[model samples]
Target: MLADTATIVARLTEFLGPDSVVADPVQMGSYLNEPRKRFHEKAAAVALPRSVAEVQALTRFAFEHGVALIPQGGNTGLVGAQVPLRGDEVIVSLARINALREIDAAAGHMTVEAGMILEEAHRIAEAEGAMFPLWIASQGSARIGGVLSSNAGGVNVLAYGNARELCLGVEAVLADGRLYKGLNALKKDNTGYDLKDLLIGAEGTLGIITAATLKIFPLPAVYETAIVNLASPEAALELFYTMRERAGMRLNAFELVPLIGLDMQMRHGMLDKDPTAGPSPWYALIEISQPKGAKGGLLQAGLEAAFEAQLIDNAVVAESLADRTRMWAFREQMSEVQSREGASIKHDVSVPIAAIPRLIAEGSEAAEALVAGIRAVPFGHMGDGNIHFNFSQPVGADGKTFMAGAQPVHDAVYEVVLRLGGSVSAEHGIGQLKTALLKQVKDPVALEMMRAIKQALDPRGILNPGKMLD
Candidate 1:
């Protein structure tokens, strides 16, 4: 049988003092209230561990008593991975354990505690004349552990790859409180099984990540950014291929935006001014990172070639820092502006780079057929083929009524995604939200392997129980 809330709180308080343990329901609001405000289950307590040793101790007690423990970082996760699944579980927040363990700018690697904020990691790397190039929308609030746990892919994923690729090694506490001291700066070590890769995107079901050694690169000399007007997704695709061919790996971000995004932002006062070159049916926010000591004007040259090929009709290349900032703001605020419009059903899925245009066209048509006047706001990292396909409710429809019909909309979108050989969940890791969907969509053998690995590592099923593999 599981321990009650009082027993859990008293034990946690004994382990980490009264100040670090928050058992009062009213005091635990921040931890309970996730970003989406979707899951409403209350946690028994919130344990803030200050060091690695404290985390191990907490895990030890939870394992012995068969208590569920949820590992949370900044709580900025769109999916409810970092939030409580069961009301009886205790939340372990890593916000206080943030610290830099080691750094070597010349070596191009740094070891940081899991709780370190991603934006702070960027600043630290910048101070050393280098950069940790994983740029995500929630970098300001997302912590290193949570980012790695989710294997987060941000805008710059086209150039820098995701969190799993950026990390060289990680230190974690296993389900039974045994420390897995895997922290290292090795670029290659084919000695044994790739344990680091297994734990990264596991959503904390296997273990609690404590620290990681992350890759860093030399800071870029200049960023060439532009918002190019396109006729449709086809034009944007052609433009993407052209720019990538010209810039190669330097082409970092290629984001797609619809005209509806701009209109909604304008209607809700989200942007200071229009950032695109007038208006068009579609827009592609493309950026190229030029290293120090390299010649500039690659983006401009590529754009001229694209114009010649008739891939883009008009474009606005950012001439100043403010211009670049505003252009990025337009892309970053795509998700936020949807809330102002009304109820929205969102899907973060990815497909092969070649199939993006078809995915958008067919998916939108299918959704429109399902719900008349459902505004399809499909936009995101076009360079990497991960579109945050979302649909806003009809202008005059009731929010609750539209949301009630969300399952059909989701089914329609996922059908198109799967038919085009795409993924159901791209950047957001499966928390409690998509467990059943995972079972249905994932391969049978793959699920078996995952279960075996979970059982081997977390026999007690104490670390982030009822998550990922549910």
Candidate 2:
């Protein structure tokens, strides 16, 4: 039931003017290409709506004319959710609709248009003497809408929580061009069904998010970060418990990084010097925030106890801002460093915090059994139990050959994740990548409710048709 590309582009041009419509396939590359570079389907056209009214007009036209519209933000998403799947849909980029509407530092929230970049949000908060705790690596390019849409969780999720928790409410344009203004900064609203949450992580299937009121916090007085050496995930697990019991909410990040990660970064010249104390099988990037009027050395005290308990053998606390930045770079550059080693298979899976040790040990063993000499690079938010389980190809294996057998490796990891009551897609939403896996692992009742919600909200199936549900 899709119209021809030329007709669709012409109609969209009439609806939003030629400046807003991009019909040329060559010009559409930027909107079509996503982070993974796995999907290649071209969109019919890209529409840049500069205002909420323009977005409504386009959505109404799509609903009435039976056109599929894929809502996109910064297009930095890894799961191909913001990009097209069928090549018949039009991409509705919110880049132009970006505008700040309100700010209330006292209430700990601010409203910004969907098009504004994530890092800009951080700057805005800091200008008001506040802090927006979400800090994803792609903050420079990822926008507020896409971050909320994906319900992104960065290194600080252990402290401030994910995008969903940080978001108080959102303004969205539902299918058929109806505006659903639900923006509110209330701390307690026992309202009927929570619609804000439904659209936040819906991947634009339910509606297109236009703006949101996001939570902000008072800027912390100091951040104490460190790189600690551990023998195994079990040792890291014990250290995590020790630190969490001592620090509580003051603990911001507890990331896991394998010794291989460090070696790769150094060989690729990504790091000038090794951040860890010395050679250990694994390392944990532990960090804590010292609020204003709060005493320092909290992290040092916790690490001291850990060392005494034999949970950690050695550590190096960041003494300067430059040192803290280097320590974090070692953790954030994990994905990029993998490419230097050639072919890699990655999984963003999470398990119950207590079961993390088993998940890593068993998942690594299974991957090795599937392909010998497979270098396991399992690391990530150890405190939150979300490990970026990844593996590089054998020492001299062919890249294409190893990638060809990535499915079994993925199956192996997901098997361990599900067995431990873990999630296959944590932080990153199930874009087109894991739709099949979602259906297989998700509870049947949850699947039914998701389908019912999608059908109810998007009756004609015009908004992101064939995505999440399909």
State the local distance difference test value for candidate 1. 0.93
lDDT of 1 by residue, 293-386 (tens): 9999999999999989988889999999999999999999999999989999999999999999999999999999999999999999999989
Best by lDDT: 1
What's the lDDT for residue 406 in model 2? 98
Give the alpha carbon lDDT tens digit for every residue of 34-63 in model 2.
Answer: 877889998889999989999999998899
> Model 1: clashing residue pairs?
none
Go through the candidates in order and give each one's C-alpha lDDT: 0.93, 0.92
